[model samples]
Target: YDPKRTRFRNQHRGRMKGKSYRGNRICFGRYALQVLEPAWITARQIE
Candidate 1:
């Protein structure tokens, strides 16, 4: 997790961005989740 007030550079954010193999959330207040790969039976996130 990161501090909401902390700033991130474009390069730093790009490096931290998640790939398709791992689940990630899209930006812009979409409130959506992305799961492109297989995961364990109980591994999940709820928001």
Candidate 2:
């Protein structure tokens, strides 16, 4: 998600339940997530 353009990234947030994350997933390392506040993140989907 690009916080600079859209905070919610096409309306996505919170926990995702089975078969949902396949297309919508963000790869943030444990340390990154812990260090970077979700709001402060400029983007998601690491890969």
lDDT of 2 by residue, 1-47 (tens): 53577555566467633333243444664443232222333456444
Taking the tens digit of each residue's C-alpha lDDT, what string does model 1 give over 9-45? 4434223333455335465785876556544334454
Highest lDDT, which number? Answer: 1
* Position 42, candidate 2: lDDT: 44
lDDT of 2 at 29: 48
lDDT of 2: 0.43
After superposition, candidate 1 runs with Cα above 4 Å error: 1-29, 41-47
Off by over 4 Å in 2: 1-12, 20-47
Candidate 2 weakest lDDT stretch, 10 residues = 32-41
TM-score of each: 0.21, 0.16
